[model samples]
Target chain A: MGRTADYTNERCSVAATLEVVGDPWTLLILRDAFAGVKRFEQWQDRLGVARNVLAARLKTLVSHGVMETRRYSERPPRHEYWLTEKGLALSPVLLTMAEWGDRHVYGRDKSPVLFRHKTCGCAFHPVLACEACGQVVDRRDIERAGPQDLTAPTVGEALDAVKIAAE
Target chain B: MGRTADYTNERCSVAATLEVVGDPWTLLILRDAFAGVKRFEQWQDRLGVARNVLAARLKTLVSHGVMETRRYSERPPRHEYWLTEKGLALSPVLLTMAEWGDRHVYGRDKSPVLFRHKTCGCAFHPVLACEACGQVVDRRDIERAGPQDLTAPTVGEALDAVKIAAE
Candidate 1:
């Protein structure tokens, strides 16, 4: 059974972002958007998603301002979904996810879809780089400048006393 | 009512990855993994997730090979979770998601957690770049180097045939 997941009570941004676009369907629709996909029919055909589900997802995206509907055909009342600046910002999230899937899930060069750099004509992946040095960063090179206490053990002192029963 | 979502039948890497770590709790766990939190107790304490729920999430991660458990205390039989090579590769995904959440959800400099580059003594954000040129790439600058056809309009020509019904 699908679970009813919500992070609204959490103050974390990831939780908040997930609240809006965390669903696989929503992410998939956004993936299509990066491909310049527009129109209700286009998303339905590409994703093979049910019509109502697709419509609901699109509506959610629009309400969140990740996407907007523009009238493409006046007489026909046809509209197309377009990514807003906020939506466009999701490219990295999608790209990095695809890359992870490509590397770990599909193996190198096996995934069907690829993002190519226009300037270099080379296939590129997302890199986490330092803004000051432009050097690629690894976990070992970074530290948490936390505004919250991630170190405090919240389970209680009684649990901490259980080191004698350890495992 | 909650709905079950699955992309198992899809060939997409993103979909495949989602099948493994798509749940909000699962991602939050991974985010904690990147932060160097290893013990079950640490995750439980930090996330405030239900014990059974956190246990289940940790089990899923371990079974998927994203994480591994190591015996840490011999007398107590204590164990700790650590990221595997495959799991470490997920840092970019977590980082990027956090960046997106910070920028769009919480606004700049407001996220309680910030990743600071130790080398540069500066806060850094994830950027997608070309491997060859190393310059930042945008959607308009790059085109899909597809091994698949994303340009195909799927909803049937009869609907698109309504161009005469212009909006």
Candidate 2:
């Protein structure tokens, strides 16, 4: 191993996010979620993941508001987990990372969970662009346009959502 | 106790990248590279990392052509490492991850690195936008203007880069 990896003691935002979603299972969970895997048993079956690990990841995501648990069956006290807005917002991040992987790591002919634009009816890259100008943009070009109101106690980050709407 | 995360063996690209760069030392090394930390000793001092691990990560990145090693000081037979175009291309990925960490893990006021747009002089979100419309784009709206000469093994993807680009 090149470097000894440690995240438990770090107080960085990426680490914080990673603390919840950095593992193979969590992302795969989200991947399945995006691919329409909602039920816990379905996730367990599709991913071939341990039940304990799946339960824990779902619990953590729910605790963090990345996912929500809704009662689907009253008799069995069964609940269905769904992506919250916060969870759904991660689509772009996942797509971008997937694209990056597809380009550099995966086989050239690997099949990806294809995404099609609902509005324009086109298949596109997971890119960042200016809505007003239609040109590609980076982190340096956008500004925080919404209020910051975090519910949790992050090391340094606020819990409020920053609107991505470009000015 | 939290969840168990081992990204190195995962099949996803983020996991694959993390297997290479997600570790603290590798990230710090890349951080130093972007920060102009080229010398081996400099990385050693700045990151408080083991010399062997540092050497290994560097070698690995160089092998992948993410960074290139060049002889700079002939007097001592010394060499320095610089990022390749592929490495430079990772700027957005790094920034996006860092931004996520800063926003979710660390608080806004405590962000380690601050990015400002040179042209507009404003803080921006490392967002993904559409190349055609120049608007903040999603995955669905983009078609792959894929690689021109893909010689790597093909998996099962149906469309080629040319076809994706033509769309």
Candidate 3:
């Protein structure tokens, strides 16, 4: 709380993303959304969240363009919350979180739910892979580059990189 | 917070995981950990988090076994926080979250930081692949199985599945 509360402008992507979905309840809402729960009452009942909290989270999501609303019925003005393409792209974030939980928290075969690949029909886990080389990313395999790189820089090099990237 | 603040026992893995690292500040600390900031003062300086909050989070992480303490200085018995194997396993959760922010918030090629796969030396993005079949996983390719399946379950099937899995 000491720093400025506005984190969306941070250069750190995780910080930026967490600004949007770091709240445990917000992430739960997104989990339900992926499960095809769209109606307000459904999320309320499923998450057992306070009405005000759910409404506020939904509003934030819509404002951020992660979700869009469509009227399911005009007669009573019922609306359904749906994931926008940007929200759908968060599939990996959520899935990998779940994957970590399954492995480290639930202990593999003890997972309460299973993700079965529909095409392959095998209960699966999310593997992080390098898009450039098609290699499964091991923790030992990654290094940071650019402004945050742990090593190396010329004068103004870091600032210039950020400015260029911003542009 | 109504249901239970003790989320570590939740049946959901993401929920359990969130119980440990869901706090924005906690996640930020872990981010710094991955960036190789180990000592107490380093995290404090980098994050600007209040001493009490930072101390509480480090204690929580150590208690949960996600991190461990190693004595790095004998003068005052100073210790450095380090990620345990279980904690290192969370690399994907943080990295994927950053990847999402890079794509959705910053736009492609605008990331302030880039992850270079040291093995290949290419700035890379994370791709979710199904560990079972070795194919890249698509949203369209995954469906829930067991208790959380969207449809088709016998009376006791779901409950029984959870029990068996929890075993």
Top candidate when judged by DockQ against the true structure: 3
**Alpha carbon lDDT of each predicted model:** 0.72, 0.58, 0.76
List the pairs of residues colliding in candidate 3: none
lDDT of candidate 3 over A1-167, digit per residue (tens)? 11323344345778877877876588888988998899999988877778987898899888777999999899978999999998999999888888876766656745677888998889878888888888887878888765663342321343344346546
Candidate 1 residue lDDT tens string, A1-167: 01346565566656666767887688888988886799888888878889988998888788767888899789968899999898999888888888887767666656667777778878766666665778776768888776663442222221222223333
lDDT per residue as tens, model 1, B43-125: 88877889988898888788667899999999989999999998898888887887887777666756667778888888876
DockQ of 3: 0.46
- Error (Å) of candidate 2 at residue A82 is 2.5
Task: Give the winner by TM-score: 1 or 3.
Answer: 3
Q: Quick one: best TM-score, which candidate?
A: 3
Task: Indicate the docking level reached by candidate 1.
Answer: acceptable
Q: Report per-candidate DockQ.
A: 0.30, 0.25, 0.46
Residue A101 Cα positional deviation in candidate 3, in Å, after optimal superposition: 1.2
Runs off by more than 4 Å, candidate 3 = A1-9, A149-167, B1-9, B149-167
TM-score ranking of the models: 3, 1, 2
Candidate with maximal lDDT: 3
List model 2 lDDT by residue over B25-56, tens digit each: 55556756876778899988765767888898
